[model samples]
Target: TQVTCRNSLKNPLWSLIEIPIISSVTCQTVTGLIFFQNDFCARILLLELKWCVLCLLLNEAELQQRSPPSMISLAGGSPNPNTFPFLSASIQVKNGRTVTFDEATMKRALQYSASNGIPELVTWMKNLQKNLHNPPTASYSPEKGQMDMCVTTGSQEGLCKVFEMLVNPGDNVLLDAPTYSGTLTALRPLGCNLINVPSDQHGMIPAALKKVLSRWDPSEVHKPDSTAPKILYTIPNGGNPTGASMTAERKKEVYELARLYDMLIIEDDPYYFLQFEKVQRWLTSSVSVPFPWAPTFLSMDVDGRIIRTDSFSKILSSGLRIGFVTGPKPLVDRVVLHIQASTMHTSSFTQLMVSQLLHSWGQEGFLQHIDRVIEFYRKQRDAMLSSADKWLKDVAEWHSPSAGMFLWMKLRGVADTQQLIVEKALEKEVLLVPGGVFMINSSDPCPYVRAAFSLSTPEQIDEAFKRLSLLIKDAL
Candidate 1:
């Protein structure tokens, strides 16, 4: 039996050709027969046949090389196996269960590994993401060419890599007004023009975003050479400095706007699990209500344009330096290639430890841990809110944050918080980040200031607010 192989050639010299597969003969025999039958066109087809055969052979070799280690790899520059010192390692978890990494696991952890990340840890993270975000599609295999995940040193690292991947030096990038200061720092050195989209208590206002994009005139604006923004970076839940989260409806609106404008949405959500709206019921009762994490921008992504970056830093340990990026495969592949050349991989030791911890916790245990964390932060938030009401109510105004670790206050009569930070607040021994730091144009006058209640006790929060209130009063 013969199978038909069709080759579509669009070159001006040739057209499509259909050839029957000769199962009885080699590719070389087929090529010779084609060349004998037709002149130039047959030669082109024969060359294509040879090229296809070569590709098949190369692919087979790669598959064999990547398969289980049956033969020693003398071709590559892998580190010597015997030189590694660690034999085994162990750690104790919260529930008094101890997890140990044996010799085999230790070897994988210590040595150089895949650029994307360790398979086991990536799989666990992918599963966790599926359970939490419930994305449009779930993809575990990069070979499938669908949405995939890659681990980074932290979400910060992921953000930097993504900016490098997407933004040219003179390109314009959109950000929420009063964005994360860290993001400003990251993008400043790249020479990309930063365009601030107006935001409200519900995060980036969809209407404002649409207006900015619709009215964008490159020639009339300051940066004439810069192109229109191709990306919008946002922290959907409890934005840093702003402490505002977009509602589900708002996220859908923004997602639709992104589609309309033809742009990518970078959702940097480290505080997704820390939302405090339902914490009271979860804290007061024994039975856990399903974790009420806000719907992420990724959940609304129908075109796979949302790149969601998450971290274990806030929920687990900041020192862990582990985060994952979930997005379309092409973007993730570029990030992986960058990682391969740059950091090589996030700390294998940290990846191993995090993987073990997640494995031990399971889904239920993980939810329980987040609940405990939220309860703790909820108390601090209450303390801050109460203190603000008591001491700063007349002088400053702020919206109560529903998630993450900040209170963004707008003082009534202040022109800029930077002057207060430098001259008044510091003198009064109240350390808070000035709002200008979070602005796209840092030199602009800003009355807002970001105060974090994450690390302070109730008494301490009260004291800090009292001091801050006094400073604001004196400034007024």
Candidate 2:
């Protein structure tokens, strides 16, 4: 499995001077020999090949390997902006402009920081908390055992640290089916028993949860808990694979359920800022708008059971890898112990950059930037949907996403999207993610595939779809 390249040492001029100069050398045939080590003294054979008619072809030339071209990446969960270009100004910067970081802001944002998070960032986060969760901010008060906020690499890290603290090996945890794949991947090594609850467009069905919880017995082999679940995970805004957003009423219902059962809710909402509904944007702008920026599980918590995980990746750059978690101090304190042992603290530089960016943009500017991003995705979604309607209306069906950057297309009458994607579409140079990749249980067949419009151009989008349509047709 090794490739060797041989380069000749003599220069062309030197070779001509030493020997008779030749105009060109014709290679009648190129032979590749293969040797196999077997029972006998290593058998050798001539490999099969074909050579074309005489023609002068360049050879022994300097060939450099280049990285693959930046692709029409219509596979990951992302937003496309061709439909709505919100940041018309930002993307049109002049040359030679450098991005600068705030030094004073960095020092201020650091300063040993509180156990929960830096005091100022904590204050900023708490203000967001108040906006999202309407609990008396006074109750969290000057010194309630609540961890105001703890910054982590991102929500995924926060979820991991929380799981490490709350779950012992063999303990039971409940996850929604087709949950965020990262959550399952992270928790697998912890050896906790996972139970997946069934869900629909509104998110984890209350009736299904009630049934699952009622049937649970502590002494049973696969039972989760004698009391209640250690944690209940959900992505309320623009959930990963399903793209379901939980309504305020549903949030209240889930909150009450969590309160009655004494379980914590891990609200992993990276896409909170990316809410797609034009109405939600107007609501966010209204004078009556409240904390955490929108109606969140944390906002509705009369009891502090919601461990809210928020990220800057969707709004800011993903490379920053910055996010924060807010919850009761005792729980956050335990999580900090894990953070102290693991990553210590998220990069102060990263936190400061985001803080400074926010300071410069102000609340209005921040909202404007988010709108720009959302609008971009909105356009991308429309383009993809339009293409689907024209090319795949009968072959595929999908729900128009209310938020986030994916189209969860269920191919009509196609039982296995995985095979179609892996064995067929990929061979034709059109890539798509099969639904099975996002499932908690891999054995299950999902008649769905995820398409992303965040990075592909309109023409490329059409071509990719055409290729996909042909592949699906061939499958039928």
Best by TM-score: 1
Which pairs of residues clash in candidate 1, taking residues 3 or more apart in a chain or in different chains? none
191-236: candidate 2 lDDT, tens digit per residue: 7778888876767777777777776542332122243465788888
Error of 2 at 83 (Å): 49
Query: Which TM-score value belongs to model 2?
Result: 0.72
- Cα displacement (Å) at residue 353, model 2: 1.3
Question: For model 2, where is the 10-residue window of minimal lDDT?
Answer: 40-49
- Candidate achieving the largest lDDT: 1
Quantify all predictions' global Cα lDDT against the true fold. Answer: 0.74, 0.62
lDDT of 1 by residue, 1-476 (tens): 12233332322211233344333212332421111111212321233343332111112222333778786444445576568999998888777978789998787678766678777889988777776667764642332224689999999999999876666666678999989999999999978789988888899998888888876653323233325576889998999988999888888888887666557789999888889886222322365466668778776665667788998888899998998899866468667756765787898788988888888887778888988998999898999999999999999899999999999999989999899987777788878898998998889999999999999789988998899888888888
